[model samples]
Target chain A: MIDKINKISDVEWELKEGFMPNMSVPARIYISELLAQTLEEGAATQLANVATLPGILKYSLAMPDVHWGYGFPIGGVAGFDADTGIISPGGVGFDINCGVRLITTPVKASSNEMPKIKRLITELFHTVPTGVGTHAEKKLNEKELDDIMNEGAGWMVNNGYGNPHDLIRCEDNGCMKGADTAFVSKKAIARGIPQCGTLGSGNHFLEVQKTAEIMDEEAAAKFGVEKDNLCIMIHCGSRGLGHQVCTDHLKEIEAATKKYGINIPDNQLACAPIKSDEGKAYFGAMAACANYAWANRQMITHMVREVFCKIYGTEYDELKLVYDVCHNVAKFEEYEIDGRRKKVCVHRKGATRSFGPNSPDLPGDLVSVGQPVLIPGSMGTPSYLLKGTAAAMEKTFGSTCHGSGRVFSRTKAKEGMSGQEIKEDLEKRGIFVKATSNKVIAEEAPDAYKSSSEVVRVVHDAGISLKVARFEPLGVIKG
Target chain B: MSFEELDHTADYLFRCRGRSPEELFSESARAMFSIMFENNDANNVGNNGTDNGTDSGSNNCSNNGSNADSDAVRVKKEIEVESDSLSNLLIDFLSELLFVAEVDCLVLSGVKPKITGNSLKAEVFGEPFVPEKHGGGTEIKGISRSGVEIEEISEDDGIYYQAEIIFDV
Candidate 1:
């Protein structure tokens, strides 16, 4: 059922509407021929389904790392009319605002520091709560949670979890407005109360890496990444809070579908008109989840810095945040659709916003370059630090691929290998690994995902985004 | 029919041969829901309570024997689903069933799902159950379209139907 695609370029393909009924737009895939052939027929079929969604502007787009996912494909990018489109929980995914943040340190990656690197990772794993249902040692009262919902990472900085300057580099300054905590359910709030600083599980990790290469010297310098400098990247999201929020809103939107007479090809794509009560509620709740996620990662930054202090005997001033970017989020931003600037709610699931040079939203220091786009690779792979490009804004709605998207299923990875085997392999390669469960380790083996280098290559070569620096892993921690 | 664990997650899949697509979908839903509760007996409740807070109503059907009805009495209603891909179609189908179950407390009795190109058409049956009165079965947690599959291959027994699904704790 997947043989109908016609190649458009070395890294692009088109799944004609004849491949699926009711498809409003042709599905466009950005992938190598090898990866495209390996793709499950289901992925293409799903992309076609996404095309049928109401208010889907342009083509239903998929990145090179495209994979099958609920509602929209994991690497899918689509925009709906802010006034007429509908929002689906599956589009933003259960891991609301799941993203990556990079922090550069003066420490260099070296053999002499290998042991300390392992110790740092160990300390991080010990300090950060992980796995399913794992909660943090600290709890947030109702007032505090509300404040966090409103302030996001800024609240964490106010509480001394991170430096104030850190927000300058974070997307949306780590806080999205119109986050109504009242829209967030009590169950979600309860789940988030003690999970603000936890890492959670399933492809989430904290890695200590070194800047291995600089693709754009000027851009790299602006982002504060230097060759051989040690950097820390944390990947996580709102955890159970986000999941519950999606669940709560999915039902609400499902009901709204009936009320608004919105016909969705898939129930997972259940949505309400953007101006409806359901849409407003979901937008507010989703923003709240985004804030919760930012605050969650911000708290994790505190834990990472604390662990670093214990391992290097240095102070927090020694390590600095490069930037934080959320991949799974929907935002209302003004962009030119044809020739006119339209305010659209851009839903980027498994995609990151890449606003190019002179973007007013970017910090002044980075205005001449672009927003720092943190694209993390799979464990043991090279993660890239890219800068947004003008082409991104003009072509792909100011977005780029998120990471080395999963190629193989976790079961497939675990069936042929063991976590212990993966750990040993990484250790032999000079990369230290620590995790709460071996099962998780196996599931997240680098082999389970596409090479981030290749994903970055597509974006860079496509001129949608510009590469800055590459970070090679030295040590890692996974939940 | 084949069944495999979906990756390392708590999701599972069961592929079964059926005479029709709706039958395949029915078995798939049953197999997926079986993960949440013990489906071995019609009158046994191990530890999880049988009362699932919400009303089971007259339209609800449990997997147990008390709610069992003859195939003749099982009414088949046409079902159609639209999605971006086969995997999502399966997920949306299951999610729709879950939503119906939650709102109406009806357990789908049988499903004969047919995939004609990208559009899915199925015949689903809804029946009522008295779990507490029947002294069997537990409340369903939640349903998810996790590991889903649709294959055209037919076994000697019948047509093959399979997919993976998750149930909330």
Candidate 2:
């Protein structure tokens, strides 16, 4: 399989159609040689398999951080033609709208302010509930849950979580269009009500960081990022509610795959045509889940804000939302394909939306610049902040990498390391760490993941997204 | 130990051996809970009166000072997970447990499940978990389809049923 892939450039490769018998188009991957060194065999084959799906356009593309997943490889980006394409739950992933956001602060805490950094992280950890099976005591009734499903971040803002500025900074204004709770399952709704405003376990975290390096001065200035200033990065998703939504929809799509006479290589790739009832219903439910996730992050942001106020003696607006971006979602948008404008369903599973400068859907305040592309690193590493570029729109449907891909298995990590030891090691380096279990700390050890700097550099050098700034964690909290 | 840990780059998996179908199902549940409950003392220690965090200490981690025991409370819930195949049956069973844990903060202890008509019905016993008491561990999100299996394993003594499940965290 490795021999079958043809290198097109220093950072691009094409997998020919013969790589998969049913491929409608050849697959493409954008990765540097350093990253390609660690790309697993299954990840590349999965990328090729995705090209075999009906209605895949131009190519089945993956970013540098690609890794093997259930069906589609993580960091996958593919657009299906609206009139003839299909929607698959695997493409959107089980955790709908699992995403990340950044908050800039008037907090001028440098790397030297270890105590203050520790205090802020500790306060935020308590403010936002985390870990597996973790839920909030401030429960919302069914009515409020439904409202959040339908309203997204607006529900939080209306309920006084934040002002209107918070909504504008989020993708889709934190409210996905065409979202309706009617199609969302009752089970999904029940799970969502309690899980909202939580930081669920496994790779999800809230880190207190300071801007360590700025690569693009103009873009950094536009993004309100000042050198050595403190910032908060929250990485989580819609929680159990979104998980149920995907679980429920997968069954529907699986049956629809058989009824619609669609042939698939893997059951996980079960899908329905965009015009079919199953497809529309799944879209509605997925949009609602996306909306729910936006609201989830907004509520967490509100809690983190309170913690900030307490720690820095500042007000809510003093900690402004930089932007929120969803890495797992299917969006309905109009893109110019082959010189003709057409509607399409762009599935970004484990990939971030890199909306270019002046794109139609960008928030008005950000149109002149571009959407903020947040690429969070694994624990104890630097996360990158970048801007969407026109080159991305031309080559990869305005998509970019999401995070530092994994390397070591959880079992290997546990066998090789200990959470207490890792915690003490990080503390020795001036990083405060808090976690529910030492096991989690061990599993998420910085050694367990690929170097995030290597992953982010691939996209920045390829021009899919331009690097704006890089920040290193000062304190960390995780579930 | 009835179960052994398997390696996966992203998530963790457990392989279990049981003497029969009933044992296989029960052992699988036990193996999963083993991961969910990492602290044996926390599970066995009865109401230490140590004033640890309550069943819902998500917001009170700092106040608890250390990873102290939680305010434990007794509770019971009926759970049922159905599927066409025994492999899916095991996956569904674990998934249902995970769902309850997230929604109700329940830390399930025991299950005596009976299989009937492609479904398993069980009386799940546990307490509403407090991070302070339960010793917060890795939270599983869903069961993965990548490597789930159920089969018969033959030994020198006799034949036994076995199951393997990979959970996505």
Instruction: Tell me the lDDT of model 2 at B2.
Output: 79
Q: lDDT for every model?
A: 0.73, 0.82
Top model number, TM-score: 2
lDDT: worst 10-residue window of model 1 chain B: B52-61
Worst 10 residues of 1 chain A by lDDT: A129-138
- lDDT of each residue in A349-410, candidate 2, tens digit only: 99999989999778777788899999999999999899999888888888999999888788
TM-score attained by model 2: 0.94
Measured with C-alpha atoms, the lDDT of residue B80 in candidate 2 is 82
Q: Per-candidate DockQ versus the true complex? A: 0.06, 0.42
lDDT of 1 at B109: 50
- Candidate 1 per-residue lDDT over residues A99-207, each given as its tens digit: 9999988877775778888777766766786543345667789899888988899999999888888888789999998898888987677666767887765678889
Model 1: residues with Cα > 4 Å off, grouped in runs: A1-3, B1-169
DockQ of 2: 0.42
